[model samples]
Target chain A: AQSVTQLDSQVPVFEEAPVELRCNYSSSVSVYLFWYVQYPNQGLQLLLKYLSGSTLVKGINGFEAEFNKSQTSFHLRKPSVHISDTAEYFCAVTPTGFQKLVFGTGTRLLVSP
Target chain B: EAGVAQSPRYKIIEKRQSVAFWCNPISGHATLYWYQQILGQGPKLLIQFQNNGVVDDSQLPKDRFSAERLKGVDSTLKIQPAKLEDSAVYLCASSVGLAGGPPRETQYFGPGTRLLVL
Candidate 1:
């Protein structure tokens, strides 16, 4: 089984400021990592995923995450954020051969003007 | 193509009452999933269906929760004699399934059904 941990529960940033949401995971086997964003009362949308080949993966809405195997971390980062970027983000992990994903408690991002 | 759809965006019920949530997966998709998301937490997978059969339901609380996919198109999830702890958002997701390996395909989700137990 795989599990994920998001370090921050809430993050507040000003518009145009850079932000990073930290995520770490524990899995005994090879894993696939993903980041998803959820707006208020809405379903989650895929941000990006780290399956293989590249450690740095980019996704929609100018978001990117890096997979560090040694650290077991897949932290999401954006060079500049917008008010529309404010939402809840979740990190998830699925083992190499598993179909289901185990998710981390979401981190709320509040981008202010 | 339309995204996944769910019914009864919100519902309120007293303890011990029964409630059901419905989901319609995207066209041509062969895999479906249901998850329970409690406040202040991430969504937890309750069950997974490949076509009209069960895939993985190890985490499901069998005594209180049951789900089915009829005709492999629409699915329904029910909770019997609900408890206060059962108040949460129920999410439905679907993905395309291929042969010969794990279904590593990306999934699309529907706006969840929020349930409140009083």
Candidate 2:
């Protein structure tokens, strides 16, 4: 019963442009993908993960995410963005062995300048 | 190193009163977590611990919520009576191993505690 679907609640991008923060998931089994980054008050950090190797996944400050598994999706890219990169972005799912995670309802990232 | 530790970063209480929150982890981290963010949503896993027992708390809300980690590296989370949807933001995380294993560890957060149940 996993679920996550961040279709962008807000994304104002501008500091250097180039951003993408969309995510989708539904999982029936076999899953483990993440991307987190809260900033305002803090708590939540870990910007890359896709356990099981190689679907892109780059994380940390530079940010990157791919893992498309037939379009279940896991988007979160950033070719150029700064202004501190703003914050608030989440998309999680866990089901491989279940560490329990199923989030997705965030995507602020308002980095203007 | 020194990452997960939370305690009253902010609180405002007012609906039926009663509140408590505290956490400290990341020194070997045997796994610990408690989340509940809700100001826009995303972060919800009320309880989970593996060092002091309790593998998962289902969804936590046992009557009015309550948590404890006793000796597994400090932890507490109580919320009797309060409800304004319980306000939000109460993260605390840690990770190292031992909970169904396989080494996927990566959960280190803590700078949250903003509860305003008015």
Candidate 3:
């Protein structure tokens, strides 16, 4: 079984400031990584995914994540955040050749004006 | 393309009551999924269907939960004698199914049905 751990449950950052949401995972074999964002009263939207590619992957909303195999991390980061970035973020992983995605608890990103 | 659709955006019922949720997947999609999401937690897979046949339902609580997809299009999930802990959001997702029968695939989700068991 695979699991994800998001160290920070909440993050408050000033508008236009850079922010990072930490994520770590434990798996016996190779895994695929993903990030999803949930807006208030809405379904989750895929932010980015790290499949077979370069270490750094860019996603919508100017967000990006780096796939670090050694550290087992895929932290999401953005150079500048807007108030609209306030939402619950989730880190997810799935074992190679498996379709079931296991997700972390979540980190609430609060962008203050 | 139309997205997955779910009915009864909000539901409230007492413990021991029964409730059912309906979902209509995107046109031509052959794979459907049902997930349960408790507050402050990510969604957990309850069942998966390839067309009308179930592919995986290991996480579903058979004692009180049931799900089915007929005609390989729309799906329904029912919970009998619901418990207080059943208060959570029920999410529906659908995929194009494995192209060339590949195992891993990405999924598109619905808005979800929020259930509150009193």
Top candidate when judged by DockQ against the true structure:
1
Candidate 1 residue spans exceeding 4 A from truth? B100-103
Please tell me how candidate 3 rates in CAPRI terms.
medium
**Interface RMSD, Å, model 2:** 8.4
Instruction: Give TM-scores for every candidate, taking all chains together and pairing residue i with residue i.
Output: 0.98, 0.34, 0.96
Ten residues in sequence with the least summed lDDT for candidate 1 chain A: A94-103
TM-score of chain A of 1: 0.98
Any residue pairs clashing in model 3, and if so which? none
The per-model lDDT (C-alpha) reads 0.93, 0.87, 0.91
DockQ value for model 3 = 0.56
For residues B1-118, could you state the per-residue lDDT of candidate 2 as single tens digits? 4788899899998998899999988898888889998899899998888888888899998999899998988799999999898898899898886646622667888998999888
Give the TM-score of chain A, superposed on the true chain A, for all candidates in the order listed.
Answer: 0.98, 0.33, 0.98
* lDDT tens digits, residue span A33-67, model 3: 98989898887888988878799999999999999
* Candidate 3 residue spans exceeding 4 A from truth: B100-104
lDDT of 1 by residue, B60-114 (tens): 9999999999899999999998999999999999988665333457878999999
Ranking by DockQ: 1, 3, 2
